[model samples]
Target: MPSVRRALISVSDKTGLIELAQGLTALNIPILATSGTARFLASQGIPFTEVSEYTGFPEILQGRVKTLHPYLHGGILAPRDAESEAELRKYGIAPIDLVVVNLYPFVETIAHPEVSLAEAIEQIDIGGVALLRAAAKNFASVTVLTDPADYAMVLQQLQDRGEVGEETRLRLAQKAFAYTAFYDIHIASYLHSQHAPGTFPDPLLLAFSQMQSLRYGENPHQRAALYRSPLPPAPAIVNARQLHGKELSFNNIFDLDAARALLQEFPERPTAVVIKHTNPCGVAQGETLCAAYCRARDTDPMSAFGGIVGVNRPVDLETAQEMGAMFLEAILAPDFTPEALHLLRKKRNLRLLTLPLEQQPTTSPWELRHISGGVLLQESDGPGVDPSSWRVVSARQPTAAEMEALLFAWKVVKHVKSNAIVLAHAGQTIGIGAGQMSRVDAVQIACMKAVLPTAGAVMASDAFFPFRDSIDRAAEAGVRAVIQPGGSRRDAEVIEAADAHGMAMVFTGRRHFKH
Candidate 1:
């Protein structure tokens, strides 16, 4: 292949544009740019020929027709063979040895809170993606770069070898295809989302970008990698900034997700959740974050050890100092005061993350779980309870405070694993039993886990009781109220047991089995 003699450059994220242009110029490679890119190069005092000037055709249709001319593409896409050379020579086309073009930020454009369809459509680059694909197709002869992060390596290769190697070209070509494919997927998905509303198409196009690679999956022998959608699904931990700490491990991510999901349940209040093995062992909402943390931690101090903690409120010095008392694995909150960050950073291995709680979306994206042969896809169980929809099934109705505790417990149970039971009082979980095989066993475990008095606390079951035994056990354990989705064969018997104990019971008609 011919050495790189000329290069085309256009990029929406102009991160390394000037440096790349300078390097190319130093290598005596002339740069061809268009519109904003040309202006940017000129402003940076880098010599570049505008594509319109090179093609002898003025940019039309608001800069959309700049690089579509054969003058530009033919130079980049032509083969290195004699026939291609003859065609290039006949057309007086200078062979473009490199094409560095990142398409317009369609994903970023649509990410705007108020971005209109017209605005989003306008950001789509017709020529940019075409140029990337054309250069990638002729990777045997030309190099294609769709990421600015590749600029340093590409320039180093050019500077060292006077040209990019075929191997490197092949790698860049593969990346370029992936780059354009993800871009197109986002565009198509966005357009369809606007046109079709709630409907998912026959072939669902899910676009994901790697956030990071995990050390392992659930166990050290398993492999795992983390990827995220193009757009952050509001109140996302993926978008959170790690202020200080060790890298988030697979277990950390799982536990943090569980804690954050529960934290979102009490958005307006100062909420704290302690999660271990992807199950909330303690959760509480208080007037202050420190108080919430204390209440949550106090619920099951043993389980809180080395567990991930999540708080909906910004962490202050007091809270951080309080947290410093325990050997915690990680803590996630909206923000932390400088003093708090300083205090927390002392624990070198602790992971500290910041999330914006107010930005959580009311509706959620799909939840996907993989099995041996297929994926289980379902909507997230985040749309919370409507108290008015809850039917009081027992002889006694819940008081105002019990109703609050019952709703709070109900929210907490949704995040627990199947056969779950949570006992909460005054918006805090006193005990929790999750992933048990039997409802009665779950109730017994939950009662056993309670460090505080279970008396007058509300019990929340993810599903209806299979028998009256669980209800009777809850009553024996001093649970005054119960919240569960009633749809069992013996629901009437369970209600009768609650009535027998003068305990208030609510039927939600909606189950939260998370197995």
Candidate 2:
């Protein structure tokens, strides 16, 4: 049998500690505990030696100086080897073969609104980190327990193998490192925010929690995982726990996040957006939500197959019937009426998500993206473009009716994937081309996808066209007007092309790239 001799137990939370201590004692492992833990063990009729007794000194400095001694750390960290054993015997040190420790209640203390700054600062632990690092360093011979959920697994391993395995020790060590990193990030962010309120820091503090393991990435063979920001009171997409469905693919979660983010932009109005892949296929607004669904669906019925739909109003029976006739992978709305709920229940595979409508803050502090072993952070695009800020650089300006269509198309174009071209007539999207490699190619594709020939439609480009080729192509497709953020050196050439075709043009001086 592997020698199970010494164990160190220290904890802020007392739940299940006595029971675990009793189990360890029954197995002939000596439990060395701190002051409070020792008292609890004695009260429970479970025997344990005080940590101060083992270290040959009483705890000082208001019990904060107990576990910082070299004797405790050396026993936990010393490798099990002949040379080390000889040194340990010369110093009369007994190896700490097991360590059970949990950090102070920093998260819990800060969670309470009434906690003062002094109390919160005191909750930042010192001894717990030392104990964790020591135990992790000697993980080859010691089992370090941190989370309460690991109790059963450790007990089972001790019961089955008579000792913890090396593989399990390494895995636990990795978890310990991750845990410490997360804790340090929280502290650093809190202190930095308190010190610097408004100014942007050189490096941002971004933290994430694993949400799920996906079936695959964008393709079938690539591995993928989903992570959400560790903000208190989760956002809609992050808080939405999947109750039922096949495992979500990475692309599925991306589209879902896009749909939710856009809908959060408009909470008071009845609107509908149809998205395929990562681009908007159709979008419409109406007084009655069912009317909006009708207009949005008719925008591009052919491309709506297997797409995702998001609505800003409660779903009604009439709208549900229209949705049920078509094939859709998912639908999200503020709520669902009883009849609508009954109708949607027939489509067993369709994922229905209902979130209570709440107004989103108009500003965002930061946005983040994952890179290999690092991350990129920047500010998120907060509000929609205001047409009053636009400048008319073209010789001929857009009429009031065309200006309305241009602004409407501009908002929808922002959510479409890069290399985006959208054609709008009146208030509805007539054509959308996205994710192509060239601007002119996107224009041709979008015009070809138009339900009508686009004789009177206005086109919105997400970014400035590098050349005038895209404007010429749009003119050939019978586009009546054009709207793009004007920053290109060849802007005059593109404006001339629109003027040559007797079309109206406006420049918003704002770019909306969704890459």
Candidate 3:
């Protein structure tokens, strides 16, 4: 490839601009920069020619039309063939060997709570995108850069070999294309969301940045990587910081996310939950973190082994000591005390992740699932639980204690798989049955899985029971109260069965089916 003879620079993010320009100038490469970049370079004592001076036309439209001229695009898009060379000379265009540009902060501008649509529209970049696409298209002869971190590497290569290699140029071109696509996707999504708030667009566009390549996928033979959404960072597993432990596996990430989702249900209280294979084995809330963890684990100690643990509050020394007794795969929390960290660090292979404590957990507007042919999207279940919407269906009303346990079980059952049933006493779950084929089978499994006594335990079902068999089974297991989304065609039969068994039942009128 030919050495870089001239470069064009127009960027909204000016990080490392001066240093890159100086390096290029040191190598005897002339630079043509737009007015903003030229002003910055001139102030920093770096020499560069302004774009208007080279194009022989003043910038119009408040600097928006600065780099959209043919003189600039022609230079960047020209190939290294005789025909292209003749056309370049015919138009008095000097070939541009490098293009460095970063788009305006459209994402950042829209992130503000009170930003107007006109303000966001003004930040949607046109000239920068055009320049990047033109240079990236001619990667055989041009090197395009959209990231500041690449400046040093490109500069080093030029200093060593006096020219950028084809491989590096190709990679940079790919990155530039991705950068522009990401920018455009965000702009389109924002505009569509504003125009039609609760409806899906005809052609959906999603953009994600790869966070890491996992050692393997759910299985050893499959390949996998983790990607983060393009939206602003939030307190989620994707944005969590790993303080100690070996690299996380794909299963560990999945279990940790399940634990985090459950923990989000009880943000105001000190809670701990144990998860196994994306299902909650035990969940409990207590006045203290250690007590909560112990109670949660004690609910089903057999299933708690090698499980992922999530805590709503910071881990203290007491909780860490209690956790150290178990062979846990990972733990996710907001923060950890120094003493707690010191104790937990002894388990070298245990993954410890921390999220931002100041921000509450947030749910995405949509839930997406992938199928064989395409994808499915729907509204998120929620971050809210309103017991006031429930109606007492059975003749007997639940006591305050039973009501509390019923609500606790209801929250936990939402996170469980389909055909889910949870048995709870006090504020801790005593037995859980998830992903069963039948509701009666789930009830029986909950009874059999109980480590604590099931007598007086309240039960929660993710959906209505189609028949009275589930109610009979739960009553046989000593359940005193039940909460479910009551929508079955045989609702009268189910309610009569509950009344006959002396069980207090509440209908939420909302089903939570997780498949």
Candidate 4:
């Protein structure tokens, strides 16, 4: 087959546009591009025909209708076969062999702290989808590039063979299809969140754009990458810039996200969470931000070593002084005082990030898991537990001090990996058991690790106990009270066990399983 002769170039992220355009021009391919892209090409001394000249129509609607013309679509979608070529010639259409296109600045535009509704709506692209689909549909004969990361490989293939091969073309086509699908999912999610619901509903649409391929996962053999949720522009996992330290692994990213999400929940309050292996090692709230950090650090001093710490309030000098005494992998806060930043900056290996706390938290609609062959999806179990409606089911109602500890444990337990158990006394964690196969096992592990079993400790379970056996175990370990979502059929047996042991138990009517 003859080499691709015509290429269209358009992009918002112009990372490798010049290099790619140069390579295409070197191969004698005629480049056609939009107004800004065409001007850029001209400035760079790369030859290109304006898209309007090729399509015989000016860009209208303030550039919204630039690439939406049938001439552009017909060229990209036209097959290279004799009949398709004859038909295109009959209709005055030229075959477009390659499409290098990226959508508008939707992600950046919506990420602003106070973006208006009309401004957000305007960021969504129309012609970009048409260009992607047209090129992707004719993948057998055309190459479509949507990501800047693919530029190097595509240029290498074109350099070696004067054109991208069929295999490379197919791979690019697959990427284009997935890219467009994710983009549409994001638009659907945004519209649903902003508009009235119809009879046919897309209740949940969660899409992530991969930020980077990591060195490996938790284990070096497993592959992983940091991914950000589409288009909303929260200072989420994907957007976190690593200021220092080594490359982030899968476990690090997981733990960081758990800590960050919990911090977002209490932006107006002074709160700190120390997370290890995607579970809360310690979590505390206090009057001052420094006090909160100190309390959280004291909760599990040993476990906090090399763990991620997240703060809801600004990090002050006092907090930084305390943090500098120990080692940490990462620290995230809404902001940091100048003195605090100066002190913390001395620890060059620590990754520090400051995020603008959102006025209202964006809730995820569904949870997803990728199996070997497919993916599993379900609704998100986001903060379903109501604190005010909880009932004291045990014979002995919890004292005020015990109630405070229980509430603290309740929030910490929800973010821990299941099957999870947390033991707290006063305002700190005494012991924690995480990622066990059984609930009873989790209880035993936590109790075994406790510094003082009889220290007026309260227990928090991530989910309802399937049997009263776990409650019995907690009672034997001198647990004063238990907090758990009471949804199991045998909840009566569990409550009776607590009562028999003269322990206070609260049923939250909600379960937090963090697997």
Model 1 lDDT tens row, 1-515: 45898999988889989899999999999999988899899899999999888999999977777789898899988888899899899988989999989888899899887999999999998999999999999999999998888999999988888989889999999999999999998888888889986665547677789989998888999999888877767777677788888888888887887777777777778889899998888899898999999999999999889999999888999999999999999998989999999999999998999888755554456677889986777777874578888899889989999999988999999998988999999988999999999999999999999999999899999998989999889999899999999999988899999999999999999999987
Model 3 worst lDDT run, 10 consecutive residues: 355-364
The clash numbers for all candidates, in the given order, read 0, 0, 0, 0
Which candidate number would show the highest TM-score if scored against the true structure? Answer: 3
Deviation of model 1 at 375, angstroms: 2.6
Residue runs of model 1 more than 4 Å from their true location after superposition = 358-363
The alpha-carbon deviation from the true structure for residue 81 of candidate 2, after best TM-score superposition, in angstroms, is 5.3
The true-structure Cα RMSD of candidate 4 reads 5.0
What clash count does candidate 1 reach?
0
Q: Given candidate 4, what's the lDDT at residue 244?
A: 51
lDDT of 4 by residue, 1-515 (tens): 43687999888778989889998888888999999899888999999999999888999988888998878898998778899889999999888988999987766766675888799888888898789988988888899999888988988877787778888888899999888888777667656756753323445556777778989888988988877665543655666665555667788778787887776655556888898877777777788877888778777788888889988777899889988899998887777888888888888778787665544556555567888986778776654346799999988999999998898788778777899999987766778889999999999988887755445799999899999999888888889999998889998888889888899999888878876
- Candidate 3 residue runs with Cα over 4 Å from true position: none
lDDT per model vs. reference? 0.89, 0.80, 0.93, 0.82
Q: Which segments of candidate 4 are over 4 A away from where they belong?
A: 1-128, 136-175, 187-206, 232-235, 264-269, 287-290, 336-348, 356-360, 436-441, 452-454, 465-478, 487-502
TM-score, cand. 1 vs. native: 0.95
TM-score of 4: 0.75
Provide C-alpha RMSD values for all models, in order: 2.0, 3.9, 1.3, 5.0
CA RMSD (A), model 3: 1.3
lDDT string for model 2 (1-515, tens) is 23557999988888878667877887888989998888989899998899999889899988777899878888888888899878888898888988888888776677675878788888888888889888887778888888777777777778777798788888888777777777777777766756885556656666677877878899989998988655544245666544334556687777776777666655656888887886788887778888888888888998888988988888999999999999988887777888988888787778787655455533446666899997777777764567788987777888888998887888888888889899988777889889888988889888988886688899999999888888888888888888999999998888888888888888989888888
